[model samples]
Target: MTKTYQIQSYFNFLKRSTNQHGVHSPFVYDLVTKCFYDKKKYPAYQNIKAYRQHLLSNTTTLEITDLGSGSQVFKTTKRSISKMASVAGSNYNDAKLLYRLTHYLQCDSILELGTSLGIATQALALGRPKAALTTIEGCPNISAAAKASFKKFDLKYIDVVTNDFSEAINGLKTNHYDLVYFDGNHQKEATLQYFETLLPTITNDTVFIFDDIYWSKDMTAAWNIIKQHPKVTVTIDTYKFGFVFFRQEQAKEHFTIRL
Candidate 1:
């Protein structure tokens, strides 16, 4: 509980620590401005917002079954979809930020480790129309509901997998992920394992986003390992996410700029 409180405080501090102006690298600057700061409205963002709104409105509950490291927030076996949406789901700001990143990167292939109600998946899909996003959900029921929502939106190139993250990542033949979102396990060991497992899948342009970097001390240790890895050239600590990049051209630098 103390660790959780400390992490929350760090997050509160980070919410005021990083932003777009402090970045000087042309590439990073453009990314922060166009991706993080741009407020120009995209019609697709509205659809994703509506989907989230629907999730918030619905009060239906489901018998949630856990898979892939389980959840820290959910203490009981049964949970409401709307409660989960409002509690566990990514908030609007995070969704919009992801949307902007996908739009800026023009990423075609994306991998999402966790697909809770498909909120982030919808955001990514709406962010880049041409991107083919493969999101994994441990629970079949949740995946089913999310799949139905995707169908309702007529979203193409979005695949939902219901299986262990390890098995799914192992079965992957192609290693062409432009952006990988790690929102599954918050534990240090699992985080490191997933990072190592996905290491070979990364390209020079690959961008990996790890959620809840400060969730626990162990997670922070894992983040340190990820940042110090030889192949990792740059990292950005945006509090909610630790963005790792493997670009050969860029110098090794970590930015904790205020977002």
Candidate 2:
């Protein structure tokens, strides 16, 4: 059986959308055109896409012990890495969006909360070769697998931290991050905590992307709170994800864009 009616509506809404045409801000408009619309054939994209394919084909099993909010697709504690990759990993669209977001920002420093199979992490790294990517994963085995795959892809700037997301984030000294991707914990409390904790680190150009924004009503509530923050100038809701911008030059506005 399926869950979360908001997720259903969210997916449905995402199905009907175009590129950022009416995005009035010059910065966002250029980002949409140059980054989102960029069709340049990068060879690195093939490697990232193939990494997902390899995960989908893998039959070897790894005990999946979740540390954060548990998986919605898995009811049992034990699961195969292949099955987890097939069912629990970020979908192709999200991965591509991650790439676009990173590419748009041209972020020199990135903090990723989850490194599931390194799909999104690779996307972020490949989008910006100069970026220093620090990704946190709770599972050592999963993180090892991801690190090996990153090597295979020749992505060298990634620093995979195998630890609890909250602890790692708290211990971090480098507070300046051009972008932060929140995908480790889907719970409302954890999401809000991370948002508030990282708020002081953001600059006027910082962009924060939250995954599974409509996973539950609680997540929707969290997303609402994030959008209402005083420093948050603009928000774009794409059902599955919510993007927050801290640009001081822009007026506070929200757009439910179909992506």
Q: Give candidate 1 regions above 4 Å deviation.
A: 2-18
CA lDDT scores, all candidates in order: 0.84, 0.82
Score residue 39 of candidate 2 by CA lDDT: 72
Clashes of each: 6, 0
Worst 10 residues of 1 by lDDT: 2-11
lDDT of 1 by residue, 38-85 (tens): 888878778878999888887777888776556667889888888899
Which structure among the candidates has the greatest TM-score?
Answer: 1
How would you encode candidate 2's per-residue C-alpha lDDT over 17-67 as one tens digit per residue?
445776777776676677656777666667667988978887766666588
